[model samples]
Target chain A: MLKIDELEKCYRNKEKRSIFHTTKSKEEKKALDGINIDLKEGQALACIGENGAGKSTLIKCALGILSPTSGSVRLFGEDPRRNKKYCMQKVGVVFGQKTNLWIDIPVIESYKAVKQIYKVDNDTFKRNYEMVMELLELKDIIDVPARRLSLGQRMRADIGLVLLHGPELLFMDEPTLGLDINVKYTIRKFLRQLNQQEKTSIFLTSHDLDDIDEICDDAIVISKGKQIYSGKLDELKNVYADKHIIKISGMKTGNILSLFPGVELTEKENQSIISWDKSCYSVQDVISGVFRMYAVDDIEVREPDIDEVVSRIFTEGVSI
Target chain B: MKNFWTYLKISIKSKLYYRTSFILNMISPIIVLCGQVLLWKGIFKLNNASDFADMSRNAMFSYILIAFVLNNSLNWSTENSLSKDIRNGTVVSKMIRPTTFLSQNIADMFGGVLIQGLFYTLLVIVIFFIAAKDLFVPSFSNLLLFVLSAILGMILRLMINDFFSLLCFFVTGYLGIAWLKNAITNFFSGAMIPITLFPVTLKSIAGYLPFKYMIQVPISFFLGEYTFADGIKTYTVQILWILFFIILHCLIYRKIRINLVIAGG
Candidate 1:
């Protein structure tokens, strides 16, 4: 479990004074401002933000890698700044851009080193090592040096290394960034299964919306160092995803727009795509009306995905 | 202790991973050692004497050989490596683990130097056996003292290097700091020239500094130049200096953690 209350972090500018400008600048830039998050046991929380939105900063502050300027952060009911070793013993962190594995050594060697570093006993090390190896599918690359592996392979090895100690919580920053679609899905599935079966709490920050959709249930949206939205992921989708798209392909669909009062339609060839706000028009009524009045060969309905909902929130400044 | 050994093992494995580089590094030191020996021999030849500064020709050669081996043993690029880690934000990996940063760096230094140290030490023994069997062989007690002092010296060197390495957090580059550290340490520690050959004033000043203990004093113990009383006095100073740097590192690191700006995500 983790608790962060009104956490704020500010970085001072390191501007050199010129001969013409003798006075030093004392300006401080806030990377995180009055942000709060409480992640319960076994809860997977997604920190959604764009580049430079202070999402990484928040994770660093919570991990005691960077001290907060103000407010407090507690990991397992202890201040991480003062008790980093104690908190870190139960925590696993994976920085997607950076590697935790020793680059020149085989991935298996790094895993063995982790076992000694964390003082994991033989039995537990064996069990966790086997589980991580199987789940991360590290059989082929385990003996290769980390520097020789691809980004996806290295990331998988890193994740496996951290889990060898059986950490109670895992903090991942863009775990699937820059990976192929298959690799991304593999990582996401591995993480989801870990959360579901092992009950390891996950605090994930990623630009990839699908990672969030697959791995996290609760979500907090950060923009400009501010917590703009915090609630259930489903609720966030429902709130900003108010519009639905209905695509119907037929020969004569030019007059479909005239039948619906507030629907927008675009026709290309034999396909007519109808879009409308669900709050204004009942989907069932509209579908029945179009079915009765128009000749339709094929029809399909689509709801807004998390990616579209998040884009809308950012562009429209939707907050709750 | 477990973490320390784990780090040491991993560091050794990494250093040995690149065979060409490791072999090259091992051979480079021998070339430097031979070059230094020839240079010193030429200096003695030019002086037209079998002794300089109360050291006979054989004693001076032995001193050079031992110093070369000891200096190579203590050499660690902690500052450069740490500065790189800090600049690139890879230092976070070390910080997040449940191990002390100082111990980890110390292990890495030892791991890196272990192979070279052993090789050079064996080379020295072989050279002494073939060239000068009776050249400055210390008594058993003195050899024990020398071994203890040398271990402490290695630790002292690591502590000093780490102290300078931590300054990378505040600076953009480490070149200047490293140059300054090397110049000061080499001059005062007698790694460049034995403090015994210095002018009276310079030698006295070196006597008061911690750098002398890092190289000259330990060599003194190995050469049987230090009495029991002298060994005790030198050790007291070495321990105090080690403690000083350790405390300073702890204080500075505490401040650094608060202001640490990891360069990249």
Candidate 2:
């Protein structure tokens, strides 16, 4: 539903000038560099990278909030820049920190405003308002002013505002960030359900691995404004699947060190965490041998988190 | 039209959401009006002409009261708000909306004017009527001219304000410029006093300038000072300004948005 071709964006440093303002600085920051991406209809894509990854910049380009320095973005065969109104109707975007609803307005009133902005009819307004409020579990607080609600409550309302028009493409930037576990889970669940039931295409950028695991079918990793990886989330996981974390308590550091070869040791007094590359040795063999060598009080082994894998790809340059 | 009403209702609800702040906003205007009334009354007494060389003390008092209400109601603050919106990222949401950003802004402005202007101006007019009974009531024809000129004046004022606001997308910190524009406009526009009281040069200069049409011309038309021909000529000037600024607003909007997008590049 979204296609970007050879997109490049460079931001000029207007604030930086030569002495006496007679000269302009040629210095510029590349926010997006020759990136090509396509998001299929009804597919949920997750964008993961460290800070300054240009994830937000890329999304803004797609949304026509920022024009690419070169190339172009097309949403369903129309230029988003020229056809903002039509494109906006087809897409819903929620910036992580900004709530679209006015803080002093009640949730319902804000929804009404959105409804009018999108020209939703009375019947649709009622239906969408009811459905969104129920799905977001915001029935009780829908009449309350947005400023009076907690962050989580406001976020749900923000999502509700986005969905009022039943947009086919949803660009969610860390929608679950800073939410409590229950709210996070609820949002993740809602996202999954929305995508599956409505065939909504979602472009999500989040730091939450759990959100990615719960909702994304495809994942794209970018580093320094360049795409590093793009494919199935599991495939990307497999590519970075060499290491397994083994947390061991009641094992002496020296003894644990002796048990495994090529194991990266993380020690803390009586506790030690071992990162064993499965490529060098099977995690099973390493853990079993460690269990036999030390008097093990407790041990837990799990795959490396998606965040760690993605961060490694972003910061460690996909070499290690 | 539905969007307009929806925006109006939402704005009102938003304003009322902070009940304390809403109360304060309403009270601040009233307090400022009271101060203006007191100062104007003081000036009248010190002028030592209860009859004021043809303009009665009662007429001047009512004129001051209405002038205060009109100045408060007619002036627009959207320039500062628009500047802040640009500085912050709130304009992004408005950009995403199906409506044109300019239309959305105009609706918001009208909403504020409708609610705050109507409420506050009504209060001021009621108080003026009760406090000063025999100031001046225009003939029906003059009343008609007054209302027409006032409407035209309001449109001109908003156009000017919105035009300045569109400049925010160009300059850094245009709020200061917007404020200075407002102060200068209000001072020369005779929103505080009729232009007739000014020096001959200023009065003549004010006669030709569009600023006078914003307050003095309209109120003077109400006072039956302007002949029909004179009223039409003044209104034609206000309309010309309205058209000029409307075009200016559109041109600036396109230029600014393009520049902003390019700069973002």
Q: Say which candidate scores most in lDDT.
A: 1
Model 1 error, position B121 (Å): 1.4
The CA root-mean-square deviation of candidate 1, after full C-alpha superposition on the true structure, stands at 2.5
Question: What is candidate 2's CA lDDT for residue A186?
Answer: 85
With a 3 Å backbone cut-off (N, CA, C), the pairs that clash in candidate 1 are none
- Model 2, range A25-73, lDDT digits (tens) per residue? 6578877787887999999999887777888788878987666789889
Model 1 misplaced stretches (Cα beyond 4 Å):
A18-24, A247-254, A267-272, A293-301, A313-320, B74-79, B200-205
**Model 2 CAPRI quality:** acceptable
Clashes of each: 0, 1
Residues B123-155 of candidate 2 have per-residue lDDT tens digits of: 866775686565676689988998899888877
**Candidate 2, overall lDDT?**
0.77
DockQ of each: 0.77, 0.38
lDDT of 1 by residue, A240-268 (tens): 88787888877663365667777887889
**Which residue runs does candidate 2 get wrong by more than 4 Å?**
A15-26, A121-127, A241-275, A278-304, A318-320, B41-47, B50-59, B74-80, B127-134, B166-178, B196-210, B230-233, B255-265
